[model samples]
Target: MMERRAYPLRISAVVLDAMQRWSEDELRSLNAQIEFVLRDALRRSGRLRPPPADPMDDTDGD
Candidate 1:
């Protein structure tokens, strides 16, 4: 599991309601849906880097 931190956010009711509906449709909690959207945007904008490869999972056909 990934470490998580909570922060206060203020959003308009319209946006919040839409997000709630979308999250329910996707079967994810509101918090997870919000994080997913933020993370996706960050990745698309090249502002977030991918995690390093795990050395223990090397699969080179030797």
Candidate 2:
């Protein structure tokens, strides 16, 4: 399991409401949804490395 660090975040009311709605729709807790968005943005911007590919992946037409 990954170690999680807690921190304070100051979010606007409108953004928090939107995040809550999104989290409900996705069936994830508010915190999980927030982390999901942050991780996705980081990966897309190349600030974070993608997870290692699965070693047993054999979907390629070999």
Candidate 3:
């Protein structure tokens, strides 16, 4: 397992509200949804490699 670190983040209420809405749309936890968005942006910017397929995507085909 990869080591995970927890750090406090300060975000505006409006941004947090938007993230909450987006998380519900994607059926993901709010924190996971934020991470997903950040990872995608990183990959697009060439700062990170593409991530593995999302397990959540499989649910829609069932």
Candidate 4:
């Protein structure tokens, strides 16, 4: 089963508009485009290294 997470993100109007245009042009969902961009940014910024053996952390689970 896939786990769901939520985050608060702040973005500039110009960047948001660009993302909207890019998503419409590519016929991709807004959520998908945003996720793709975020993943690319994380990789480029070296924030995401190799995946852990278990990708999910259950410490937050009840």
Indicate which candidate wins on lDDT.
2
- Write the residue-wise lDDT of candidate 2 on 1-62 in tens digits: 36789999999999999999999999999999999999999989999976778778888968
- The residue-level lDDT of candidate 4 at 38 comes to 78
List candidate 4 stretches off by more than 4 Å.
Answer: 8-10, 52-62
Tens digit per residue, CA lDDT, model 1, 7-41 = 99999999999999999999999999999999999
Tell me how far the alpha carbon of residue 45 in candidate 4 is from the true structure, in angstroms, after superposition: 1.9
The number of clashing residue pairs in each candidate reads 0, 0, 0, 0
Q: Quick one: best TM-score, which candidate? A: 1
Off by over 4 Å in 2: 51-62
Tens-digit lDDT track for model 3 on 1-62? 34678878899999999999999999999989988998889889999965577766776756
In the range 1-62, model 4's lDDT, one tens digit per residue, is 54669887788999989999999998998778998887899999999776656656667676
Error of 4 at 38 (Å): 0.9
Which lDDT values do the candidates have, in the order given?
0.93, 0.94, 0.88, 0.83
Q: The CA-based lDDT of model 1 is what?
A: 0.93
Question: Candidate 1 regions off by >4 Å?
Answer: 59-62
